[model samples]
Target chain A: MLENFKFVLSHTTHPGNIGASARALKVMGLSQLALVNPSNFPSAQATERASRADDILASAQVFVTVEEAVADCRLVVGTSARTRTLPSQLVTPRELVELILQQPARVPVAILFGTENSGLTNDELHMCNYHVCIPTNPEYSSLNLASAVQLIAYELRLGFAQTPELPEQRILDNEQPISREQLSGLLEHFDEAMRKTGYLKQNHEKQIDIRMNRLFSKANLTHSEMNILRGFLRSVLYRCQ
Target chain B: MLENFKFVLSHTTHPGNIGASARALKVMGLSQLALVNPSNFPSAQATERASRADDILASAQVFVTVEEAVADCRLVVGTSARTRTLPSQLVTPRELVELILQQPARVPVAILFGTENSGLTNDELHMCNYHVCIPTNPEYSSLNLASAVQLIAYELRLGFAQTPELPEQRILDNEQPISREQLSGLLEHFDEAMRKTGYLKQNHEKQIDIRMNRLFSKANLTHSEMNILRGFLRSVLYRCQ
Candidate 1:
């Protein structure tokens, strides 16, 4: 899947972004990188930024135009903050992943990024099969080139990452079930103890019983928990007597 | 809603990104800034990068951990390039805008950004209920931290920029509700009853009382709801007598 997809940077002005892009792609298990006339292709800054991902840099293909870069690719995607003058289909990064996954594995896919100052030109955008827009703050939608790359790469990685099917949850082993009779008996014992301590008057007994039931229901007392509670109630009754 | 939202940049490493993020937040009408474990906060380099937007830097909260910075916020959203080990609902920046817009004005929402080298850790991501991913180039998708902030902030601004219709609240004007004094009195009565039953003996009554108050306040009991509770309590007291 990684071999079929190629990342193309068109006229990237910053050497740092180019280098950072390499690192981002490598982290996501992608290696193919195509440069379309980068301003500073073989710069020390890009190499420094690439960190340990220089292999992507060494094998990077340099292209003269966006069309030439993506000419051989069966699929082409362009990234933008908003819709362009071109009439290409728009998809979010998440949707794009689904689209990418459904495509034939043999076909080469090309993702194009534009220059730093302005994004892909209208003609450049028209060359792509679809447009991918990253939703951003309308007021300040100045997403840096490399950050955009990272998000897309992250999505691709997530889409292609080996997903193990979750194991089914084990059914609870029922040792014993708390019977209604036992519950009623426990409630009666609690009420008698409360009466001895003047915790409940005649008018309040029903309300107290309701509250107690609510509390017990929330606790989800198992058989063992009910037994423990009953034992505690017996001790209270003994003290009251 | 946009005006009320605060963009907090926590523990940012690069001074330039800090400055850029400040600009991003200000443009989106989000003013609050919180910095956790920043490498060089209040640095001249950051101030220079901030350009004319100094207010974001001035009011920024500095903290040692992400928790301290976002303690008061009811909702927290973390930005990440990769999915963390912890479970979190992933959303695109656009969807996040809609979520933020729907929140009550009383609740403060926090957006967290991690260090430049590594995005938010798994632990940090766990703190957030939602994660925002910005789409970018697959081959060179290394997004700057500030740019990620910019995209999210931009989405938030767009979502909240419009005049919001008033939230429709269910009204029960006919019901006679308990006042704050009445509620306190009821709580005191309950505490007295609990003491008589020995339920309050081992527990820190003051702390429990405070927690109960918080829980009740969060419930936003209507007049009818208060009446029902009071009626139940009265019945309990009557039964005890």
Candidate 2:
């Protein structure tokens, strides 16, 4: 699955970028880099820039055209540093992850970057299913070439990695999320406890009751948490009654 | 909230990256920039790279130490491009935004980046409450500095544009997240309770006790949750006899 994603740099001007792109891909666990019509290649600078990632540069395929580079890829995403005059389906780097995940099969996926002077040619961008624009300063959207590769590669890794976790919120051994029935029972129980305490007033009853619903939903009361809240609510109800 | 998020670059080698960073921050609608021991600043190279966003470079704050740069910040996040030998509370860049947004008030925030070549020192990383790792290829993770700023600043903007979403996990009631001082007190309470119960054994005591601190800290216990835990501990202490 990881191997399906390819980074294609079209019309790259600098040899260092090809090397750096190779490095960026390697660090993010992406190996496939296709460089199309690069101004320089097999230069000492590319190898020097690649540092330890010379293997990636050595393995990188050269293409005569963008179409040839992305030929077999099912989904292609282009990176645009600026908002184009021509509008297209644009996704943030994070959103691109979600889009990729929704793909039914592990088809060949390519993320394209343009040359240093100008971004992807109109034809190259037109080949893409979506454009992932890294948000940058509007006045000076001068994101360095290798830097763009890093950001896109980072997003790909983040997408492949599981969603960020809140460790404390995960249920412990033998604890479960509260079921819908339990949730209903909880809301009813809250109503009774609030009524007993005379906290649910005449005019404010609907608003207060709505807020209670929202709060409990937001709290994500696990079964154990529900039990604790119920125990506290029972204690309150008993005292008020 | 974006106004309070300061991008602190430490010992930056390139004036252009620093200048580019100012543009990155400004483009994301954040004005504050702080530099800690940059190699060169007030350079024409930075101003030239910053383009029209020189106002950001003009007003950027400089500090001799990371501590001074982040002294006023309630939240300090240090960016590390790779995993380090030293362990830290690592948060994904997206997660950092959520955590920042969850802050109860608008406190100054510092996001630190290390020099272009070496990245942040272990000491610098140690200063942060959370370390944000931008996923890179393990083989070649040479991310350019300013791009790091752009990605993080973009996250901050995304965080702010988002409709004040409370993760389903956060306790939604009146209970506030306890202060660090309160957390310290709670840790002490747990330690004392464990000692009284004869639960902390001799050889394992230090490791077990420290782990316990981490567990509760990660839990982000709400006021009521802390009260419940403390009450349980008190009950256990009462039964220690």
Candidate 3:
């Protein structure tokens, strides 16, 4: 289960956090990591902080956007400190592990973390199916970004108990939710179709797009269902033409 | 429960690790820290790495030996990475927490961590009533000292339920989500806009409406956000007319 998950750090300002995050993942037996728009990479400070876990950093994937970073992941989770007015499925680290165990189809999970100063942006948080909040001292909730990763990784290590055999064979491939990339395509199709019909205005496009993304994430559309939505949007666009 | 426990670092080499350990403890609501014969103290690097956890560092008690560092504690637990020839009451971090809870007499418990290079010397390990080990990747078990502190701190946080009440998180007034009545209005506005766009056919209108509702409900839009979406829809409708 740890093998199928990737930790994505978005807009990390400090090089040390990136390196420390790599070590955190490695120590917990997790290898996959993705970095989005880091302020600095390939820095000596990062290498030093990573200690002996250079391999993780060497193989780390970098993306310009969080969307691209987690495009292939079926389950997208965001780590947030604040309980937003518009919240996703909020879970503790332990609860998150239980949630993962309950569903074998939600493989290749992406656990997203935001920048050091401000956690996952509203737009970024909107993209996730669930929001994981590490309970901290409410008075002094100033948790470091890498420390946050360490706690989450530690929970993953403790909760799994030697990687129990998941019932993956029981869940059909088509039953799995569509990948983030596929979902993005479906959202784009809807945007184009709505635009052609004159329902989407310049100012409202972003809000509509975000809302659709949030909605579809909750819907957890599978590949076949995504195809159906795409077909419907294509017909609408054709009708407008 | 956390107030009754103190973390002691024996022979810590890196000052940065000391600072980070302070941060790790403070984040998990642990305040008492004792250092035994650290290579460097009152160092700038430690302060920098401690981030805002300098208060813990400031109040940290330093001693010449691990014996002195934990002399006041009733239950002394040492953290060890390796399984020594003569292990004493070996337990995982989780188990250590359980052990602490079982015996309330173990108040003012001291948990010891050893040097960065060579974890707790045999003499140091012999002094402890229990050895708490954090399980890491066997192939690469080079867990950072501060990270180890973080992991242990996290377990303590989870194992204890009556965490001392820190101040409650302050949620701004405007950040509160819009009422359900407002949500219904927003969904109606979206339906009107979609109908005007000709994207919502009679056959697909119901599906579109439900999807929009689901999306908005998840969005948990605030009053201002609701107005933004409503305004955008009104603009689209005006254009269509």
What lDDT is reached at residue A15 by model 3? 99
Ranking by DockQ: 3, 2, 1
Q: Candidate 2 lDDT, tens digit per residue, B139-226?
A: 4566667768877877777777444544445535646555434556777776765565444433366544443433443344455556
Pairs with steric clashes in candidate 2: A26-B137, A27-B136, A27-B137, A27-B138, A27-B140, A28-B136, A28-B137, A137-B27
Off by over 4 Å in 1: A101-106, A164-241, B1-9, B20-32, B44-59, B63-68, B76-106, B113-241
Number of backbone collisions per candidate, in order? 25, 8, 0
lDDT of 1 at B74: 53
Give the per-residue lDDT of model 1 (tens digit) for B1-241. 6655556666678887787678667655677878888888788877875656677888877888876776666567788655433234457677776665554433467788888888876556655656676544333445667667766765665466655653754444623323334445556765655554455565666545543443332233334445444554454445444
lDDT string for model 1 (A76-168, tens) is 999986554667889988888888878766369898999978999878887888789876555556566766776677667667655321212
Instruction: State the lDDT at A118 in candidate 1.
Output: 90
List, residue by residue over A1-241, the lDDT tens digit for candidate 2.
5578899998888787787777767767788999898889878989986867889888989999999999999998999878885445898888988888898474799999998888988888788889999876565676667778877877777678443322223335424557778888998986775555454533366755665565556444555456544654565554444
Query: What are the per-residue Cα lDDT tens digits for candidate 3 across A1-55?
Result: 6788899999999999999999999988999989999999978989999989999
Lowest-sum lDDT 10-residue window in model 1 chain B: B213-222
Better of 2 and 3 by DockQ: 3
Candidate 2: list runs displaced more than 4 Å. A85-88, A137-142, A161-241, B14-17, B43-54, B84-88, B104-106, B116-119, B137-144, B162-241
lDDT of 1 at A94: 82
